[model samples]
Target: MAGRGGTQGKSGDEVVERGGERDAGGGGMEGWKRKGKRSPDSSLRHVFPTPSAFPLFLHMAGSEYGRTARDVLVACLALWSVTSLVVIAVWRTSPGVRSMERCKAELHRARGRLEEARAEWGRRREELQDLLRKSAQNQTHLRRQADQLTQSLRNSDASVSRCLQGRLTYSISRYLVF
Candidate 1:
């Protein structure tokens, strides 16, 4: 028997409805749990407005409707999980993504090699410059030593010629005296 608004009498048992909640003759949620049976009408209320509205579904009790809803929910969750996995696999294995990653790695390695090559070139250049400077200095030192030696030879030649000339004159005069 239906009561004023939210209260109903079912087989002399009291059922109360308040703000979308139902109290089945006990107290509240605890009383509902103690009964070990959910109010069928409210279980899938959010999905189906009435039992007649369910697609290809016959007039069933609340428990059966709840079971059907649960099965649908499980099936939907499974489908979503499979779709998510497929998308992830495709993203991971796509050639574009893989190629991009490979290109990035190669670029990084190339940059490192380029930097090393530049450093080597700089070091070699400095060494070459230093060697060239030292060679120039050595050349200048050798040229100065050669010039000094040439000047000393010329001076000795002049002194030797004068000494020979004086000796020749003295020997000739002695022969005349004899």
Candidate 2:
């Protein structure tokens, strides 16, 4: 049932996984197709993997001309199929060449998203640091202003004491003369 090892081909009549892929299932031709069917919502269909460029070769091979073609044409298809199989095998039993390309594209997109998130986080952190620095500077300025006001009040008190002493001496001297 399985080819080379205990693993079986996903193309077996068992429909692989019905409509959707099990989380632990390995990659298979049928698994890829069924994964798309799991969703009922049309909008969600966009979430499923699209047929990659790899399918185009298979589609062309299965065309009407493919069947009625001459011996040379059949030979060509056989060669194409063999090459396709080799590419898929070397790539570690993936669906097909096109599918792998799609996977690569998706990975690139995910990398881009990660980079964007990193940039956003860095920007926010910098903003927070700046705000904290400004708050500290403002607090220091207020403390300096308070110290200056307290010193000015002390000076004003000393001046009032001297003025009162002068008035008292003048009044006492005038009473003695009377």
lDDT, each prediction: 0.67, 0.59
The segments of candidate 1 whose C-alpha lies over 4 angstroms from its true place after superposition are: 1-84, 168-178
Tens-digit lDDT track of model 2 for 1-178: 2222122333442222222333334444444455553311234334444656333333333334533564468799999999999986888755676688888999999999999999999999999999999999999999999999888888887888888888888889999889
The runs of at least 3 residues in candidate 2 whose Cα sits more than 4 Å from the true structure, single-residue gaps closed, are 1-111, 172-177
Writing each residue's lDDT as its tens digit, candidate 1 over 1-178 gives: 2222243345544443433334444543355457664553445445765545742231232234544886888899999999999999999999999999999999999999999999999999999999999999999999999999989888888888888888888899888999
Which RMSD values do the candidates have, in order?
A: 9.3, 23.9
Task: Give the clash count for each candidate.
Answer: 0, 1
- Candidate 1 lands at a TM-score of 0.51
